[model samples]
Target: MQQLPSNSISLFCFFCMLLSSSYAKPRISSPAFAANSCNFPAIFNFGDSNSDTGGISAALYPINWPYGQTYFHMPAGRFSDGRLIIDFIAESFGLPYLSAYLDSVGTNFSHGANFATGGSTIRVPDRILPTNEGFGFSPFYLDIQLSQFMLFKSRSQMIRQRGGIYASLMPQEEYFSQALYTFDIGQNDFTADLFADMPIEKIYASVPDVINSFAYNVKSIYNSGGRSFWIHNTGPLGCYAFVFLYSPSAPALKDSAGCVKPYNELAQYFNLKLKEAVVQLRKAFPSAAFTYVDVYSIKYSLFKEPEKYGTSSVSHTTYGMEEVRINTTLH
Candidate 1:
């Protein structure tokens, strides 16, 4: 895995801190806040590899090298070499790193739980066919992750109702209501379609359905007592090492930034639709605090100006891509 530059890491952490601190403030009149004024107590995350903590590792056992070398010095299930943006966000709130929901051993749920899994998509494709691009199917789609969250909520409520030792802890409603609900999904959904060689117009046509399902899921969380949300739109998929290196495109079609033009256009279109959906959601849930983050621009900055970020390299080598492809297939 390519190491994120120090400057890029700093910017990422700063953004996370801003979002966490801004959204975690208690809304005085909302039921999500307790009588005691406290910083947000927990965070519930849903997404893919970009924010995955250990769901892949917990499900597939140990992952390979270079996955966590930068910080952990060992494979800790993060797709990158060190802490993800979510990890920095947790730290900003003075909370321990959130544990993957599937992880069993040495797991602590006091802070929060991550439902993200590598390869996950907002919606599962009808059928997954192997492509030269090396993408595959993921059973842990957004709906499944949402189901897991609902299960967690149900189990916690059951424990509270039994008057168990945990009952003295924060109430289920207040805990979930005050918790920061974050989403970093939708990339794989579009990527799967692209890898399948679906036409651009067809892929564009699917955006509404995709965002509708996403909106419904958000509403479900709100009905379940969540009051604060931090939703990250899809990043620049065209700028990814695999897409830039392998996707067939004429030299004339490449953008000034050296990214495939069509792919990046699709990503921008999706982000626009997602932002619009968030606006509708804000109006729908007037009591909730919704913050939409433009992750594409942030990540693109690192890709566009690696030297400025103190990184020796930005794109991946052919050997590196092959290695990642093999490891992704193994999972």
Candidate 2:
């Protein structure tokens, strides 16, 4: 097993690094291996709403308005008006859009399929879904989307056998190991239910358990032969639209500008916890690679510095966040 720093050492390193690099921001390497060099065949996705392209919004699950209206001109199945960080990731990989398997009626998924649904959880028996990526927040349980992904992989193999991208790319075993696996999820477990009135202590207590559950699922995928992965973590849930409206008990602070402190703090804490988890996961899964994409940072940057994104508005409600999120989602 690959060993990471203990909590104390990791904390020390984090601060030391922060102090040493305070003058410079963190550098983000490309999300993809160069198409010519990367061995992974097709990309696979798994996650909750933030990474959700259209899983829930399309199913008419009462998503916020103005979602995906900017870039898509209407809801393009994303919480935002445009593409997401994952979309950019696809582009960086020189792959085509990861069409949701649910929307794969006519699209060709030679590249891969997106199994990320809008509301999913890592461990809990989600009223939100059947597998982790819950189904439409509905009454009937849907079959595991993993089944769809397996089918897609099968077809991808056929395409390769017939001298498709697979043949064009590389051999089979290398393809499997090198294939980029993206697991973006767990935000809904923190946000959707808490906003529905779960207690704050309960939320905190559940974090480790939830992370463990997420780890279990990740192990499940690893055992199934997944290698490279993008492990997503819980989101800053209290900042969204209904959060402020429904539960005002945990009272997030705000400046004159009205930035919600409670929400931001909860988000920051979640990010910290997730960062720690990533270190642990990396240690556990050395053969397979994983990168932690801090969506919270990307999302926060867009919200804090609206000018960078070229958008005119800095709205706060879930609707506003989604609007800004849409642009961030896009290139």
Candidate 3:
């Protein structure tokens, strides 16, 4: 990931980068393969709400209306009013939006399956989910997601070999090795720690373990036939609307973008460590390709200048994309 030591200066550079190009593309870790050269047959995603295509909604209760209304014209399990980044990624590859592995009804896993769920964390939370209480955290943490992927990989092939109508929906065995494995988790780990009333120092101290757990899962996927990895670092937690409402800070404690200063700093620190972990992964698995996308910088830029991105305000909840307008012709 690119370093952004100072929010002000980094944001200025971000603006310049945006102006220089029509689309603000992600920085790729490797340049050996050009975009057109990649012919990804499928995309297997593992992450939290940021990349979740409806795992939580399907596993638990369905996401209520207005969530997928913008793009899907109804509640299509996504937490957004429109499609997510993952949806666009799938479309870019000429593949359909991934079916949630947890969803049983009308699912076709021929292309790929998504193991992501809302509120997922890199580490296990103090309170495991599947409770009678309302939503808090997901039981399908990164490790759990990994387990589901393993099972899906095995069971999918088993069913496909049976040679029935159902088997047609399953992906070809070769897809697993050639697919692009995507990740967009870890934000919830920090948020969960903060909500549990843990001190900032303690949260900072736990960074190593968090990154280690994430690395462990990535390696496991690599072992499970995943070769190409596209990992997204956590976004700007400080700019989240929930943070402003729940963890109010003085004007002096706010950044130029009006986000809580300390929280954004913590996010940047997490991203830095995550980037380092990706570097280590590359060294260990020389045959595999790892692409680290600095989503935090991109999201922060939008929050810093909402008008530039078609959003009138960044005060809306980060989990929802109701404010961000997408052109019908383009989307």
Q: Compare the candidates by TM-score and give the number of the best one.
A: 3
Residue by residue across 1-331, what tens digits does model 3's lDDT show?
4444453332323432343343454454453321223567888999887777878888877888757766798888776777888898787667889999999898999999999998788899755566554336788999999999999999999999998899989999999988889998887788756654578999999999999999999999989878888888888777776664445442457888887788888998999999999999988988888877777777788767777766666434344311122222221
Candidate 1 has an lDDT of: 0.71
Model 2 stretches astray by more than 4 angstroms: 1-40, 57-68, 129-174, 249-252, 255-257, 308-312, 316-331
Where is model 2 poorest over a 10-residue stretch in terms of lDDT? Answer: 134-143
Q: What is the C-alpha lDDT of each candidate?
A: 0.71, 0.55, 0.76
lDDT (Cα, tens digit) per residue for candidate 1, span 1-331? 3344454343433444444455442111122222122356788999887788888678754556867776798988777767777998887668888889888877777667899877677887553323344546446788989999999887766777788556544235567877888899887777656755788899999999999989988999999988888888887777776664455652446777776788889999999999889889877887887777877786666666666666644644222121122122100
Q: TM-score each candidate.
A: 0.80, 0.70, 0.86
Q: Write model 2 residue lDDT over 1-331, tens digit each, in one string.
A: 2333554223322332343344232222223222233434567777755566655544445455576666667667776666776676676555766776666344445566677766555554345333353222422112255555556556666767788434543225344455667776655555655555666677777777766666666676677677766655444454454555656664555533344656566666766776677677667866665566555655555555667777754564243112224333322
Answer with 1 or 2, whichever has the higher lDDT. 1
Model 2: what TM-score?
0.70
Ordered by TM-score, highest first, the candidates read 3, 1, 2
